[model samples]
Target: MSEADARLQDMELPTALYESTDDGYLATALTIGPWDAGLQHAGPPAALLLREAERAGAIEGGQTVRMAYDIFAPVPVGPVRITASVVRPGRRIELVETVLTAGDERPLMRLSAWRMRARSDGAAPEPPAPHPAASGPEESRRELAAFFTTEVAYHRALDWRFPTGSFNSPGPASAWTTPRCTLVAGEPMTPLQHLLVMTDAASGISAVLDWTTATFANVDLLVSLHRPPRGDWLGMDAVTTLGGTGAAQCTAVLFDAEGPIGRSAQSLFVEPR
Candidate 1:
């Protein structure tokens, strides 16, 4: 194994998905997704872009309220470049755009985030009701070997537990997940980054169609947060809807150990395998 790969294996949690290089960055195995060996999971690139956007637009006491990602091409596992810029700078609210591209500058994904100042307010809206406590990862661990036969690194890097549906079955499902690696090595992942990593699991957690005979590729991921999440465990109560047409949607309520913090939605293009 390469030195970089060796370093990644030593970490309990993947710190980052890519290692910096002279030109751009190298996509680690940790960035691999379920669909293909060459393609990466959407969460890693999204989180990476968010990290860059946050750096470009430094919000002192602000929190990300909304993040929208458009996946134009399959994010391949190799050298990639990322760029971020402030679209709308403000004292109370800021808008930032971040893009990811291949070595040849082929656009892979684009993310837009809205960050707003956080302050104490007596009239703040009440938080959503928390989902009932479920089994922890230890008690409810579910193996994903059957569904994801490929050697996807990110799949093995996370601990997943299903309370409603198994990976082989298809239906509305609820799951709790915790990452075993950091987004980038050395740089600790923030709560927001942690949440962003799990937000892309909407389609896998709740599938409206069969996995063997159908393919549901999420084209976009939209997440809105009401409050900052706390703790290692993230919950996803997801439901998927399929139309007669070739379009589908998956929506999920996001949660930390405490309660509901936000929601995430994904637009999927369904096709027969």
Candidate 2:
């Protein structure tokens, strides 16, 4: 799933992103992307899948170290069927896969993750320091993505803070984001859920192509973390490079208030709208 800052936490979003029901998970308006109000944004649905993955492969002191998502179809803003299974079961490491179906039918996406045992006794080098000019959440400019719809949607669920370029500026960009809403109706977001929900939008905040004239869709998302992300604020220092053959890729360094935590990448199918 894809899409914020820490004291922005003070401004918690008014509603949850999705609701649970006997049939399946019901996506709320918050799940809508700007591109299509009828279709769901990739981020919230990604979070739903990851949440199931975490539950299916629960282990003591375990954490998801690496996660990947493959989108087979655009998610719709309706009931979603989710199923999770453990692919490889182990004590130290495990692989869990989750599949999402639209209205209990079409398989819309797949999520796979490696859950690893956590340890306190470890020796490692410190995370690299932020750039001298790296802007904190409060220091950055407040700029939302160019929404195809003006009504509150997925982009409105989070606060955006850009220290570098913005959606309109193009090229590489860096931003700090904080979610305003809870991932599920009744649950407080876990560290993993918090990260996955907003991590997929790495491309949107750092788009190299103009949104009005071009269409760039991320085919897949890959995230590798050195540690479990913490706090309410997460930052992405992202770069996108376009290829001549109608392809593009975005790579972003992920961060929390403490420092760098991990990285996320997306491969894009790009063309003019």
Candidate 3:
């Protein structure tokens, strides 16, 4: 844990969470999650699935409009396999399915995304309401949950700034984040990759429960984009709500320096750790 004590800028971070292999990838310490050192966080793996989904190809000039992921089993911090294929292909829209698996051939996670070709007539989506009180990213504070041991990898590998409530604060919050390291070694981080890697953190960043005593783990993540995002810095204005049935949900307005781009939702199972 001492290794992560140094601030991100003061320490050289690992380049990527996974290294591409013939079958899939090998997980590195950089992917460690907050809850367990042996399990990888959801964000990086979500990004990896999107990367492969896009690579499998979609309609010509297609843009990803929605992506959904389901995590049924723990993702181990070791070698894993991934595969992507087009499930529904058409001239105007397409759907892709990607699966990540660990040893024994059981899936660690399953994901699906929808892509659509731009309207040739230049039609656009209905505009979204502007965030009520978003300050610039520069005005945000640098912080995260203090109780999390320094050994956690994914959160520390990136820079986070809160323009509203912080990771330590239990309430609705807004923050800007950008990864300090590349998503894959010797490869570039695409716009979609940049956004996916950070969207999953919304539940943690705006958690309304004490993380030390309670567990609020998201079982799924869904992100819908109205337009392509620009730049590396991504922002989210998020909130979490819990029900009496031990079910919870987190919602976030996703954006970049340019403006509003999309929204993210995560479903959680709440219980004592």
Candidate 4:
């Protein structure tokens, strides 16, 4: 393995994304992204916040039904703090909010999740539509390596396979992704945690414009799950649309090997690279 790849493989983040400090949680290189050399990717922070939310106010027999996040600033790749609280509590449902802040107390991102009790009367409605056949990762593993020239810590920690589209080209796409590393060291991730990590890839998987000359950074992410995702593989059938203005959106139908589990949407700020 390359030096960077070796670092990614043996990083301390396998047990937890950060080490607890009196002030807050410390950031790690594993959270780095390709957007800005000093900024962190949206996935790790989102998952970390969700982890806190789940710990603070998780209901028995409940699953995360919806999760929404708003990025207020570029999340720094250094020490950061997370605060979580229960907004609403109930027997069948609950709402929790988690906020991330940098060392300067500047807000980085805010996330809210809705947890609902699971119910199955043997009459659950049929899935809205059928998803495409499963596509193995080996098919596009080599292509993705060539497509992404920048070395991102998050991308190296996961295995991505595009079955319907090329990452070098732009358009609607379908891909299956699996996490190769844990969000928090030693702490096992729930199904919801696993899904949240992969949801942030919507924009990259379905790029509508040339990535070399333009940039599309998602400012917000919203994901809703009808049922908890199953298995290790998470499938995203994604499409990105850019308006005449600088705004754009990426939407994806989420799935596991079993079937469709939920949907995710991201609002992007398009600009020149």
Return the top candidate by lDDT. Answer: 3
- Please write out the lDDT profile of model 2 over residues 58-143, one tens digit for every residue: 67778898989999989998788898999999888999999999864878999999999887756786756663227789899888
Q: Give the Cα lDDT of each candidate.
A: 0.81, 0.83, 0.84, 0.77
Report the C-alpha lDDT of model 3 over 162-264, residue by residue, as the tens digit. 8888888799998888877777788988878988888888998889899888989899999999888887788898999998689999999998876789899
Per-residue lDDT tens digits for candidate 4, residues 1-273, read 557666645544433445667877776665777666577879888888888887777687677889999999889877888998899998889999999998778778999999887777589687555555246555544334333444555666567787887556788888877776677665566667777777887788788887768889899999988888877877788899989699999999988777788899999999898
TM-score per candidate, in order? 0.89, 0.91, 0.91, 0.87
| Tens-place lDDT digits, model 1, residues 1-273 | 545446746756445677877766787888888778888889888888888888887678788889999999999988888988899999889999999999679788999999988898779677657664365555665655356645447676567788777656788888887876777766777778877777887788788787778889999999998888888788788889998799999999888777888889999999999
- Once fitted onto the true fold, the runs of candidate 1 whose alpha carbons sit more than 4 angstroms away are 1-16, 124-128, 132-139
Ranking by lDDT: 3, 2, 1, 4
lDDT of 2 at 247: 98
Give lDDT: candidate 1, residue 173: 80
Give the TM-score comparing model 1 with the true structure, all chains together: 0.89
Q: Where does candidate 3 have its weakest 10-residue lDDT segment?
A: 1-10
Quote the positional error of residue 169 for candidate 4 in Å: 2.0
Please give the clash total of every predicted structure, in order: 12, 10, 0, 6
How many pairs of residues in model 1 come into backbone collision?
12
Of candidate 1, the 10-residue stretch with the lowest lDDT total is 143-152
